[model samples]
Target: MYKASCSCRMLERKGILCRHIIWIYSSNGVKTIPDEYVVNRWCKDALRSKSFNCNGDPAEEIDIIDAKQISMSKMWSEVHQTVGIPMGRSKEVVDSFSSLIREFKEKLAPLGSQMSKEQEMVALIGCSTTQEVTIFPPKKSKNKGSGKRLLSSKTKAIALAMKPKRMYQNDN
Candidate 1:
């Protein structure tokens, strides 16, 4: 896509085609502008392209800071393989899971950063085994705490529910 865009730009610079022509066509050039090419390529099917012309080396990492731009499924499959998890019945599990985890992290980041060192460690005690912190009842203490008494699990859930994290929403 980058190649196509750049070539179009260069051609327009020399007046072989106008920016209007490129905008309308938005496809590869074989040295001629067929009027029909503009209409068909602009149709919805062209939006399904898996690759983008990022204008960098194919090996270069794509800049992905926003939740929408990032493909959770792709990243998740990679980590799943690295951890030696079997290629499961659905390879897309990790990506779906990662996206969830990423959104959760973006939400929790401010709360975590605001925490004191000790609080952060306590949160870590919960998050260490799980991607997002899910405070469970302590293993050794058999006596259950009442709902009136806030435990880590209840506290974390309440925090998450009360304020949907707004920190990363700007990426849209």
Candidate 2:
């Protein structure tokens, strides 16, 4: 077993090995990364199940209402993967895909707009609250070189008095 550590601590922070660790592994003639180092979420088998918990464990109980949501999510993922393969190959393909998306958007617009403003906001932000949410404006900031430089009235008058006038001469 080869033991190595990086000063960057990328593996500890992001669960991804740093270049130094990778170089050490390469120099040691390691054929594959050890299973312990590989993060489960980045693996192909991560989503083998229909849905999983945050701890990388298969959910023991699935909600009845969420069943349809999970199925729809799976179907959409498959559809996206299938349609994304031949994208950008030709102009005809791009045009056809754009028109298809537009057609679907037109058809779905009415159904989407059926929801009230509050319902739409909840759907967009994924949060619903019984209490009123008052979002105050951001604090005024004085960033360097943002607004015009303020000058005193005396300075302004001095500048105006010192201004150069253009003298035009007539050629007779």
Top-scoring candidate (lDDT)? 2
Q: For every candidate structure, what is the RMSD over all alpha carbons to the true structure, in angstroms?
A: 26.9, 13.8
TM-score for all models, in order of appearance: 0.17, 0.39
The digit string of per-residue lDDT tens for model 2 on 1-172 reads 6677899999999989899999999999997888789789988767555656444566675437677788989989998996796676898887888789789889878886688888997875556655755697899987888678899999999999999988999999
Clashes per candidate, residues 3 or more apart or on different chains = 2, 0
TM-score of 2: 0.39
Largest TM-score belongs to which candidate?
2
Model 1, position 111, has a per-residue lDDT of 81
Off by over 4 Å in 2: 6-15, 39-67, 70-115, 119-131, 145-172
Q: What TM-score quantifies how close candidate 1 is to the native fold? A: 0.17
Candidate 1 wrongly placed segments (more than 4 Å)? 1-89, 114-172
Residue pairs whose backbone atoms clash in candidate 2? none
lDDT of 2: 0.81
